[model samples]
Target: MVEIDESHTSLPVLAFFRSPQAGRSWVTAAGLVLDTANLLFSALDVPRSRQVELTFTAGCLAVNRVQRFFDKKAETQPTELRTPEEVAAANPGREAFAKVWQELRDGGLPVRPDEEAAWQHYQALRMRYAPSIEFLSQLLLAPAMGSLH
Candidate 1:
């Protein structure tokens, strides 16, 4: 695995490492929500250009969705937040999760959605939120695939 420090990466990159490590693998990737303007001041080796800026903006949006997924905390968030489309698409998965959640007021056998319902809800969410996954995946794979110049 390639080791990169703060100098070479961003906060979202660090968060990926701090995340749960259930299985070990030789491969890992960093999906960063980067700052375009900061690159000029921080990483001298990194590019400072319009395309880089735009890419970073897109990364910011993707990571924001990811952040809201992982963090339920209420606070003043970045103005560049997740789009309505993202939320709508992921709602089925959210509803499926809500149905299966262990929380109960008057407990019984515990509510469980039917297998087909669960599967459909989950698939909907996954398909909708897949771009975020793809973005992060490509970010990590680019160097390995020799697509990064």
Candidate 2:
């Protein structure tokens, strides 16, 4: 199952896929998580991918748990959500994500440890923005988001 306490960068992805969506089952959601991970892993090194790997593994694991619950709850036709294989096969970024997600299925997702200094840089950015975030919260406003991660 997904570790609920995953890194902040991937937290939103984890949160979204883990939720029970209408029409979509665990299968499709898991792929979406991978696609997002592939995107992040490909683009962002400034924030490091620690949370990326952590949350990807955690998110995939969480989605995995939803299938049985989905199947058991069916009244007539069980939700015909696409399988992970189907989703992976059809996605545009399959070149990268497919290998990873498939490996994930067999406990093959590689763990790339985030550099300690790089992680601290993101933490430092968040700390620097803390007051601004607090001010927005105090005003009942959402602060502008940054790429702290």
Candidate 3:
């Protein structure tokens, strides 16, 4: 088991270790919705760019659905935020996000030159909108948690 050394870790990374169950559930739900959209898009003869747009829309819808489900659940059952250590104990999504981040850093995740600007803009907006550690975790870990075994 890998022990997270919080002293050396940034706040954003530590945030992923905070809500394992919610993170996993939200991610799985979003992945299901996105996968459905992907299948539907593949069957149609839409242009590649249009397909990408629709996929993005599908992802947004997934987030909204997850938020709604959890919000209602929250009303009936309050949840306390877990500490980083507690969350990391059973959370695989944190490590998965770390691996993906490393892959991006090593240039393993590539974007075409034509799309580089759009990618950068999207990243900037992501950071802008994710104003807190918890918010950042939801955005980063959801997809990762959904994909994990």
Candidate 4:
């Protein structure tokens, strides 16, 4: 039983085997978040921005790789049962991601640490571009489009 916050990057990968569509959605959501963070950080450091976005992107990439692994595995399913043994087979991407996600799981996701410097920078960015950002974020979170849950 994997426990993850709604915004956790691993959320998508965890859903991969169980619900591929959901997993894909999580990946897309992660991409949007990463892209936003990168765009924000390009002009300025934004304090903890680098840490936050990097962590998210790392999770996203790892999960995506794992998802690709599963897709390949599904294609080569030896038995209709799709046993755990099949899933445990050698897959470089999945193996690497498993290790990282495991550590993250054990330690707990960063959950946006409260570093004063980072927060101040983030606040300044938000204040400077509140309206534009709000509009863009709204597009990202639009309910009608079936956003990441």
lDDT (Cα, 0-100) at 31 in candidate 4: 40
The segments of candidate 3 whose C-alpha lies over 4 angstroms from its true place after superposition are 1-26, 29-48, 69-149
Model 4 scores worst on lDDT over the 10 consecutive residues at 140-149
Q: Which tens-of-lDDT digit does each residue in 53-85 have in candidate 4? A: 566556444444443443353332222332344
**Rank ordering of all candidates by lDDT, starting from the highest:** 2, 3, 4, 1
- Write the residue-wise lDDT of candidate 2 on 1-149 in tens digits: 25432331234333234324445433333444554564445433435468777765665444433332232432122322445553333323323433443344356444334434323432343233233222222222221221211
Per-model TM against the reference? 0.26, 0.30, 0.32, 0.29
In model 4, state the lDDT of residue 7: 27
- In model 1, how large is the Cα lDDT of residue 50? 79
Candidate 1, residues 100-136, lDDT tens digits: the string is: 3333212443333354553444344334334443443
Candidate 3, residues 1-149, lDDT tens digits: the string is 01122221223233234444454543344344443343233322334467655555645543443333334533322243545553453232435434433444465444233333433443443332122222323444433323322
Q: Considering TM-score, which of the candidate structures 2 and 4 is the better prediction for this target?
A: 2
- What is the alpha-carbon lDDT for the whole of candidate 1? 0.35
